[model samples]
Target: MLNYWIGMAAICAFAMAGVLAAGRRGMDIIALLFMGVITAVGGGTLRDLLLGVPVFWMIDFNYVWVASAASLAAFALARHLRDETVWAAILYLDAFGIALFGVQSIDKALAHGFAAPVAIVMATITGIGGGLIRDVLAQRENLLSSREIYATTIITGGMLYTFLLAQGGASHGASLCGVAFTFAFRGLAIHFGWQMPKWLTLRH
Candidate 1:
């Protein structure tokens, strides 16, 4: 299915994020690859399990292979990424993963007879689940602290996607619109250092 390929793309994007972050922290090849695979497939794994469906990577090992290949590429290109003068690149990678995952996850859920509300919840889970795993294992910044509008944008775009699909729009157009909205919102947030005001700040 096209959703499978979309999921694969999201996996690779997240894997790149994990690999880049690991490289910044000076992780060895083995450690980087492991974390990268974990970050790539982590969200989909949890989504499948929670949905009571067969875990995707277990169904076909192609997911693992794809993840590994992406990680290896990132490892090879570490030097170039290391010279980046800004963190925006990593944030954009994360935004890409979230957007693609958000759309595909909701689409999968709808195909499985799940209603829109459930699909929305699953979209959120699939969007942020992998990055949460990566952050915990790699000790990266805690995104759940509301540091920016990351998950918020994913939620908004995902819900809009579901609404459009439910209204009988063309699948490809709707998915693209959803992905673009989420990515643009998140990319801008990263570019402008957008965050909640002091009254809403939870970080010290």
Candidate 2:
């Protein structure tokens, strides 16, 4: 299914990012690969449980293999590509993966007869859940803790996808738009250092 492939691609992208990020901390290759697999499967596993479907990886072993292979590849190549600039590459890839997963989650939720609002929320969760897990496990600050407009971008894209579906657009078409909008918003945010308005920032 389209959703499956989208999820798989996102998994690979995030896994690679996780490997690269962990490598920066001087993690061993095996540990880096383990983190990568976790990053890849964490979100979808959560999504499936929340949606009351069979955990995807349990049914399809190929997803596991793909994530594992991606992680290993990233680790093997880490030394060659390791640099301060790798952070930017990770960010961009993470954004793209998030976008894809967000749209797919929204579409999947809708197909399961969830209400639009709930679908949008689930989409946002799917987009960021894995990365949050990765950050926590890696002992890095969670992206959600920042004032950066990460989840906001996912929500915006989900809303757009939901709206288009309500307006009679095909599921695939709406998902495409959702992925595009999310990638564009996050990419712009990174390039321009965008953040939530100061008025909306919570003081510690």
Candidate 3:
């Protein structure tokens, strides 16, 4: 139950980021709402479908309600917010939501009998899937870029989390550590403009 609530809160946070992003572009409430729902449930819906499980929002309508409410609320209250504010929200909220959703999705996959590597992959997809969809639909820069190192951080943390979870004791604690690792890694990247080394970059 605690994890479920955490997941929903994370979803709402990312949804608000999406709404704020759309709102900045002069999108009306309806469009913002649409983007919010896509950002919130898009990842999890993909995860569940691939895992052959029931879709999450369809199972519990609260997810949709939370997303819609958050979108509307953010739209109403973001009038005074500047462009920098939305980017700030995107940086922090996206990192936090990625951590929460990644860990939760890993747990779900592990519970469903997936192997550690598979669970890690599942969580990686869940963590970044929505961002991928949103960036595409909004015609924004691709987030899964070698230069961004954004999705790379998620993948690294997912693998670390899966490794720790497989070590036997206190999986919950391990999960939190994983989230912290991802958040800190991303924060550092943002603060430093770190990216893959020159040697690792795709040559022109």
Error of 1 at 46 (Å): 0.6
Which segments of candidate 2 are over 4 A away from where they belong?
1-7, 24-26, 84-87
Steric clashes per prediction: 0, 0, 0
Residue 180 displacement in candidate 2 (angstroms): 1.3
Residue-wise C-alpha lDDT for candidate 3, range 1-204, written one tens digit per residue:
986787677777878877765555566788788888888888888899999999888989999999889878778777644467666755676787788788888888989998878787888788777767877787776566647777777788988888786686588789888899998898788778888788887788
Candidate 2 to truth, TM: 0.87
Note each model's CA RMSD in angstroms: 2.8, 2.4, 2.3
TM-score of each: 0.83, 0.87, 0.87
Clashing pairs in 2: none
User: With candidate 1 superimposed using the best TM-score fit, by how many Å does residue 85's alpha carbon deviate from the native?
Assistant: 7.5
On lDDT, the leading prediction is 2
